[model samples]
Target: MVFKCQEDSFLKQFKTTIVSCDFATLDWVADDDNRNNGETRQLRGFNVICEDTILFPEGGGQPCDYGTINGHQVRSVQRKGSTAVHFVESPGSFEEGSEVQQQLDWSRRLDHMQQHSGQHLITALFDREFKYDTTSWNLGQSVSHIQLSTPHLISRESLDLIERQANDLIREGREVSVVLVDPATALEFQDARAPRGLPKDHEGLARVVRIAGIESNMCCGTHVTNLSQLQCIKLLYAEKVKTNVHVHFVVGERALRKLGEVFQREQQLTAALKGGASQHLELVQKLQQNVKSTRKSFQLLLKDFATAEAERLEELPKAQRPKYFALHRRDGIEVDFINTLLRNAPEDILYFLTVSEGVAAGSSAKGHMVLRGDPAVVQEMGPKFLELLEGKGNGKENNFQGKINNLAKIEECTALLEAHYKPKKAATAVEPASAS
Candidate 1:
């Protein structure tokens, strides 16, 4: 199949006749188990084949072009053995041999071209300057990355050198050319970098992209005709990935976009933090330290309050004392509060205590409980208490503790515990059996 995009990268619109059209479905498994039975979803669409097309299918580390065909949205484009299949969303299929207008999303196409060409230039420079070869690349939506075949990480100095040289070439406005070279005559080009060699099934000639006085390589993806079209190249950062270093970069309009986004964030931080861009990080660190110190002080205060609350319960009049002493705190009370209370609690006092960590009523809660009066009562009530709060806990002897999901149910759970442990009414005194 002849690809119009390869011949003319700037072709935004073209007229083509539909070679074939059929209903098709794209299927893929979701990353998460969100579906019943974990089945892959099928997206219904139409697979269209055109006599001549400007849409570049996804290949050679570049994404497919997104556009419209006959006013229908083209979702994706894929190459299947020399055939460019255009996946389009349409209610009815286009009839075979029908003429249609194809339009390429120029902004997207230009972005891909800039990134792909920038990668080629960077790859060539790395090889020339450092003997590092590019093994793979990814043309991402927002940024692009090149994987260099090296065990050691790339140094910042080396990256800066390569980036400077690449932008210099862009400023020089060197012409980029694509040529079809016969395999037998490919040896004439000494600067061409073809590590994998030509495919066995590759027809008569291999398509080679050459940057003037720089490097030439076998590439099928689209590119800008001139280096200046790239505007500029910025190497963002590099990281070691297994045996290679993946270098991230942005080119042309994307570099401008990245800069705009960063400056906007800087403005926001300046306004909110009342600090200059250079002082933002230092101020944030200081604020974090202050928060830590304040949190420690608050925790100590809660502990002291918990100790006083336990003492008040102990001082209650004997007649006013309830069968079970229960305390429910809506504020973020820690488990240590319960432990402090238990440490000072009298042996006969059966205690039900809860601390809600969540601020909202329906959020999760955590607590600890101790039943010290009766061994049988502790054993029976421990599991029931956890069940009421929708929690799981473990215990040995008279203590149990766990986390619960329903914070709103804490009051109801405590009430149930009070009722369960309420002393049975004194049995009516039996009158002496004098009548007998």
Candidate 2:
């Protein structure tokens, strides 16, 4: 590698430096995974070396450093030779010659630091207390998890003990130590666990993070120097995958906030039940049943509502043939609406009717709409039908839907269909929004 540490040093918080370097090169190629999508690749951004960066290159299954550099965000940081190559995510303004100020967003950096630190502590606790080796780890956007190489050996009781130990360590507030040891010196510490297929020892310098009395590992990522930096560590969930058990967790501010929000919502639910908190679960089940019943009732109500609507259409003069009907169920949909449409049309006449669940923007909605008429009726009316509702629909079949963007043309839809399809002076049947 180009830039190897010669001595042990820690980055002071929020450090900034300016570097003037000649642009190495730039190119656009298919992103490796897809090999079809073109993504810009600038492998030499590592040329601008800064003193302090919280962005860790991809290590420990966590993603690489991503934040603004000068103004261009460094998408991913990779090690090319001895230099850390920063993958520029967005092209803003940079050149090999143009001086750029490299910086990291400390808040974002610190959050990752806390989580990574928590992971170290938790992993250490699990290994020591339950003898489980962390085989894989992934720190993601909302949660971080690690899989134990031998999951079957870990019982629920064992997991509880690990959680107790990890959180207790967080509460105790230990000083996490990052140490540099020569590869030979690293061998002296027999208990230290390092990832497989990684260098256990280096010639001159190696990076190892020690949770004071808890855990120690060879690491290249940024982390909180003190265990106290992680305000809280929340055990979100755990599940077994293959031979390994994956433990999901959250840390720091988010951990405490999520805990409080979940607790408070459960409390509110229990209060609504008016019984003990134990009854809250049963009460939730009852509420779900009530919603189901209400849905069935709403469908029956829609039949009556549509019946009255079709009744009003019956009152219209015959020339105003109600050849088109676009009924929408804005709040509650009814199955009867679709069934009624299929049953009631005159054999010789053409009619288009639909019941959509929700409006598309302000116009059409999603669901079924069927139109059957002279092929000419649709040829003249389909475009206008979608236009009035401010929606989009196309079909040469008896129907097509993905309509209901707007409801403005419903009346005109009735007017045009009566004039063209029914071709009767008094067949006008204007529909109205269901009052039910």
Candidate 3:
């Protein structure tokens, strides 16, 4: 028995006997696996390097398949030109020439197939319908894009028209045709050309899939046999990038599910916010007013609060000032805490603020506070200052902030400043005029 396939179609099924075999399995797996966390496969399954397999590993910026085959986990799949190989996660070996049952992960493949096919149809609309050539494309897992060769601001009307035409072809159930021809004969279609990303050795014959009369391009990734194989499609997002429109799209079952999810979420949000399933705009206005009023009130409270905190922390001695840097939670204190304290202090004292890692997750922990004051008078209640707190924090410096496991440090930060630097101290200190 003999089976035949197109030169490019050989990745799917071919009965041609192997003319040669060598150790071409990628050894770079160990390096890649190590970089992606610590997942390493211990499979000893037969490493089958076939001339044909439908699996297109993540190459050319496309994601790889994630499914099982024949009960063995084919963890990695790679394709080079027309040849594809499947790396199984097992220890058993299959002879090279063995005729065995083969199957593909259809659910996963069908998704990509439709997406890839849809890209061609849409791309054709740009060229045939608008005379713009696709400059670049990225057929991602969820969305496919095309970069038009010319810069033209595509209006929403243009987008809608193209999308409508593509869907119409899919609805029509047009039979897709895959044809192979020698390179010399391939150049005969002067206007027709293969899609981007084909092997450079085009001197040999190549495989091209044509969508009925809609579109044609080179592709090794699995694609729908007919337009009907691709169900409905929805254009999710489209943004203009210089001369091109960066489109994110969805097709078939996934598109439907996504639309349903969006509508459902919208309805729920309307009900929760506006007391009905449709009063969203009214509710949004009400929310805006409430937020504005609350912000005004918060500003008043914060002004008074920060003033009181600043005044109360003005005059504490170096060792006596508890790690007050945490006062930064009040916003203004972040960079200003040290400066504010220094302003009211005698010049002999140097105010310092330090930050370190916090309890678990936070922007950062404002660690300790230290005031370099007269050493003769300085005594460290400082290290013991943080010892009384919650998490671990100690300092040879003037201040520290830990878990604040101990809240007692708060009293230390505020009291010395409040007791020593009375407001009277500031108003009364007038410097004598220097003799000129």
By descending TM-score, how would the candidates be arranged?
Answer: 1, 3, 2
Return the TM-score for candidate 3, rounded to 2 decimals. Answer: 0.66
For candidate 3, which ten residues in a row score worst on lDDT?
427-436
Name the lDDT value of residue 149 in candidate 2: 78
Instruction: Give the clash count for each candidate.
Output: 0, 29, 18
Tens digit of lDDT per residue, candidate 1, span 248-362? 9999999999999999999999998899999999989999999999988867876777677667667866665556666655556477777777777566666766667544443
Best by TM-score: 1
Give lDDT tens digits, candidate 2, residues 285-351: 9989999999789777767666665555566566655445444445434546655544544434465
**TM-scores of the candidates in the order shown:** 0.79, 0.64, 0.66
> How much is 151 displaced in model 2, in angstroms?
8.1
